[model samples]
Target: MRKRLFILGLLLIGIFLFIWINNKWIVVSEYTINSSDMPAAFDGVRIVHLSDLQRTSFGKKQLPVLEKVAAAEPDAIFITGDLVDADRFKLEPVLTLLNGLSEISDVYFVTGNQEISKDRAEEVLSALKRTEITILENEKAKWNREGETVYIAGIHDPLMDISTYDPLIDVNFRNQEIEYSKRARDYTRESLEEVPFTDDFTFLLTHRPEMIEEYAETPADLVFAGHAHGGQIRIPGIGGLFAPGQGFFPELTEGVHEFGDIRLVITRGLGNSSFPLRINNRPEVTVVTLEHEEVTGLNK
Candidate 1:
C-alpha cells in the first residue's frame, strides 16, 4: 500500500510540473474592440505588438516568426520596451531582425526596463536612433491610415529607474518604487507625447502591466503593456498566478482586463527573466485587431 501511495505521489508531481510546461499560445491573442467614434477605414485596423526582447540574439529562426506576425497584414507594428539586456551588450542582432521588419508595417517603439540599463542604454539609444524606428519617450506620434490619422503614445520604462546595469541589488521594489501613475498622466495632459485624446481613438504603449488601474481612467481607448511574462506559470482555470506589481495575489497577471472607461491588454510577454526557464507560457508577440467598441457597448 505504501509503495502504491508513493507511485501516486510521483504521478501527481509529474502532472504538476507538466502544468508548468503547458503550451497555451495559438498564434497570439486577437482582440477586436468596437468603437463608434473610430474612423471607418481604421475600423478593422490591425496591430502587432512585441515586448521584452532583452537584446538577446534571436537568430534567423526567430526572424521568420516575426514575418508570421507581418503576414497577418497588420496596419502598424508596436513594440513595448525591454529591447536589450544591456550589461551583456549587443543589440545588433535584434536590430538586424527589426530592420528587416521595415517591410512589414509602420514600426514604433518605447523603451523598457532592460533597455534603460546604464550598462548600455546610451549606446543602445544611439544605435536605435540610427534606425528608421520611432523611439517614443514621453512623446506621441501619428500615422495616417487611409486618410484618417491614428495616434500612439509611448512612455519610457518607468522600471528602468532601478534594476539592470548595477545588477539589481534589491529585487524588492521598496522606497525605490517606480512611479508609473503621475508620469503617464503628465505625458498625456501636456500633449508632449503621442496622439492627443479628445475625440480620436488612442493607444498607449507601456512596458509594465501593473498600472492598469492607474491608466484605466485616462483618455486612452486601449492600453498595451507587457512585463509580467504571464506570471511565468499558469493553471488550467486559475489563470496566470504571478505578475509584477499589485503584490502577492496580484490582480492582473496577463491578457485583457477592463477597468472602467479604459481597456488594458497585457501580454504574457516573450522571453524569460529571474529564471532561465519557461514551461506552458511560451514567448508571444500579439496581433491585436481593434474593433471600435460602440460608445454604447462600453457600459457592458
Candidate 2:
C-alpha cells in the first residue's frame, strides 16, 4: 500500500509539471515568405509577429517576449490583438509588453474580440494611443525603403459590430457569428478599396485567421492573425482540438496557410483565455523573413 501511494504521488507530480511547462514554456516559430512581387529594398526584412497576449506575462515585465523580439532583430513588429483578456481585464501587463516592444522596433497593431468585448475597451485604446504603437483601424500605413513602399493595412475585429451586447449567450449566437463574419469580410474589402491599389506588397493584420476567405478577396500578399490560440489544445499530428471561431479540429489553428496568391501566418499566441491551460501547445512567437524572388524573361 505504501509503495502504491508513493507511485501515485509521483504520477500526480509529473502531471502537474507537464501542465506548468506547457502553459509557461515559450517557443519561437520561424518562416521565410518568398514572393516574386517583393521589392528588392524590402528583401530580408524580418518581422516579429505576436498575438493574443490575453494578459499572460512571461518573466518580469514580459522580459521573455521582449528578449525574443530583440534577438530576432525585426525590421518591424506586428501584434494581431487580444493584448488583454476580457474576463480578467488589466492594463499593466498590456502596457508593459507594448512599451518593451516599441523600444525594439516600430510596432503596429489591430484589435481582437477580447479588446472589443471588454467593458473598458476605450481605456485600453486610449492608453495604446499614447504609446509608440500605431493602431490600425480600417486604415493603411506606408513603409518606405530606398524609394520603394510596402503597405500595411489593418481592419477592426468583427466583434466590434456587437460590442454593445453579449453575443455569446444570445439565442441566435451562431447566426450572429455567421452574419458578423460576412460583415468582417466586407469591412476588409471596403478598407482595402480605400488604399488606392498599388503594385507594392501589402500586409493585412487581423485577429481572426478564420476570416482568411474574406482577407483573400483583397489584394494583400500576406496576412497575420491570431485568436485561435492553437485551438486551445493541440493534438500533435491531429492539430488543434478546438478553437473559439473554428470549432473542433480547426484547420487554421496555427502555422502558414495559403489562399490563392495570398499567404496567411497564424500565431498560436502567448496567453490563454476561456480555457485555463494549454496542452501540448506551448506559447508561440513567430519570426517571418521576407525573400524577394525575381521573375525573369517571359514571366516578367
Candidate 3:
C-alpha cells in the first residue's frame, strides 16, 4: 500500500510538471485585429509583437521557443518592453538574437521599466549605441512595403529614462527627470506628429498597457503594450489576478480592449517576472494583420 501511494504521488507530480511546461511553451496564443488604416498594398501584412522577456527568468528552452517564432515569417517585428531582466542579466545574447531576427523582418524596439537606466544609466547608453535595430524614441519609421507606404510609431516604456543625449550633462545636473510615462508619451507623440496625415496606417509601440487609454484618443489605429505579465497568474472569469498599475484589475491586462478610436493589445510576453514565472498565463507573441477599408468609426 505504501509503495503504491508513493508511485501515485510521483505520477501526479509528473503530470503537473507536464501541464505547466505545456502551458509555458507549446501553447502560443495569437491575437489578430483589423486596422482600417492599412494600405491596400500591404493589406495582410503580419506583425509579430514580443514583450516582457525578463532574461533572468527564462531558461535555455527559451531560445528554441524564439527560433520557432522566427520561423513564422512575420513581415514586421515589434518588441514592446522589459527585454532585459531588470538591468542585471546579460543582454548581450539577447541583443545578438535580435540582430539575427533582423534578417527575418524589420524589427523595432521600445523601452520598459526594467530598461530604466536609473542604476547603470551610462552602461545602457553605451551598449544601445552599437545596435542596428531602430530604437524608436518619440520617432516614426516610414515603410514602403508591398508598394504602399505606412507609418509605425514607437514609444518607449513610460517608466524609463529616454534621452537622446549620452554623457551630455557632465555637470551632474540630475533630479530634473520627469515622470517616465510622460517623457515616453511626449517624445513618441512628437515622432508621429510629423507623419503625413494620409499615411497608410499608424500603430503605436508602448511598453505599459496603461497608456492605451490616452493613446486611443490619438490617431493611432492600434496600440501595443506588455508590462503586466498577464498578472503572472490569471484567474478565470475575473481575468488577470492583479496588475501593478491602475490598481485592482487593469483593463488592459491581456488580449484586446478598445479605446476611444484605437484598439489596444497587451501581450503576456515571452518570459516571467514578480514571481519569477507564470501559471496559466503562457508567454506568447502576437501576429497582427492589418487590412484596408473605406469605413467609418476608426476611433480617431
Candidate 4:
C-alpha cells in the first residue's frame, strides 16, 4: 500500500508539471479586423500586436518569438507595453527581444505599468529610443501605402506618473494615479482636435484595457491594449478569473470588445508578471489583418 501511494503521488506531480510547462509555452493568436473606414490600399495589411512581454524570452536571443513574428510577415509591429519585468534589474532580455523584432519590421512602442514602475522609467524610455523604435506617446504616425494613409497613435500608461520620481509613495498614490484615466481621455481628445474626425482610420494604442469605456468616446476607430495578462487564469466557461484593473471575472480581460463604432482588441499578452503560470491561458501574439469593407446599400 505504501509503494502504491508513493507511485500515485509521483504521477500526480508529473502531470502537474506537464501542464505547467505547456501552459508557459508561447502561442500566436491571429485576428482579422474589417472596417469600412479602412482604405482600399490597406487591405490585407498585417499589423502584429505584442503586449505585456515583461522580459520573457523564448529561446536564445528570443529566436523563437522572432521566428514566429517574421513568419507572419507583418507590415508593422505594435508593442503595446510592459516590455520589461517590473521586479527585474536586468534589461538585456527585453533589449534583445526588441532588437531582434526591429529587424523584422517597423516596431512601435508605448509604456506599460512595469516600464514606469519603481525608477525604471528613464532607463526603459532611453533604451527604447536608443534602439530607434518609434515611441508613440499621445502622438500619431502616418503609414502610407499606395497613396492611402492610416494613423497609428499611442498613449502613456497612467502609471507613468505614479511610478516615476517617487519611491516613498503609498497606495493612496496609486488611487490618485488611476484618476488620471480621465486626463488621458482629455489629452487624446485635445491632440486630435485639430485633425478632421473623418481624416483617416486612427488606431489608438494604450496599455490598460480597463479604459476602453473612456477610449470609446474618443475619435479613435480602434484601440489595442494589453495589461490584464488574460486575467492571470482563465476558466473554460466562466472566462478570466481575475485582473488587476477590472477585478474578479473582469469583462474586458481579453479578445475583441466593441462599443458602438469603436472596437477594442485586447491581447492576452506575451508573458507573465506577478503570477508564475497560467492554467488555460497561453502566451499570445495577436496578428491583425486589416480588411477594407466596400460601402453598399444605404451606406453608399
Global Cα lDDT for candidate 1? 0.67
Give all TM-scores, in the order shown. Answer: 0.78, 0.93, 0.79, 0.88
Quote the RMSD, in angstroms, for model 3: 6.0
Model-by-model lDDT, in order? Answer: 0.67, 0.87, 0.68, 0.81
Segments in model 2 whose C-alpha atoms lie over 4 Å from true places: 176-197
lDDT of 4 by residue, 1-300 (tens): 999999999999998887666455778888888999889999999989898888566778888788889999999999989988878656888888888888999999888888988777888898888895899876788988999898888878766644433424556776654565555555445544433444589888888888776677767898999999888788989999988677789998788888999999988887777877777888887888989999899987
**Tens-digit per-residue lDDT, 43-86, candidate 1:** 77888888766633444645645666767888888888776665
Q: Can you give the lDDT of residue 82 in candidate 4?
A: 91
lDDT of 1 at 67: 62
Clashes of each: 16, 0, 5, 0
lDDT of model 2 at residue 149? 93
lDDT of 2 by residue, 41-60 (tens): 99999999999999687888
Clashes of 4: 0
**Between 1 and 3, whose lDDT is larger?**
3
**lDDT tens per residue, model 3, 38-140:** 7677776778888876764334535655675677678888888777775356767567667666767778887776777445434654576477677777667
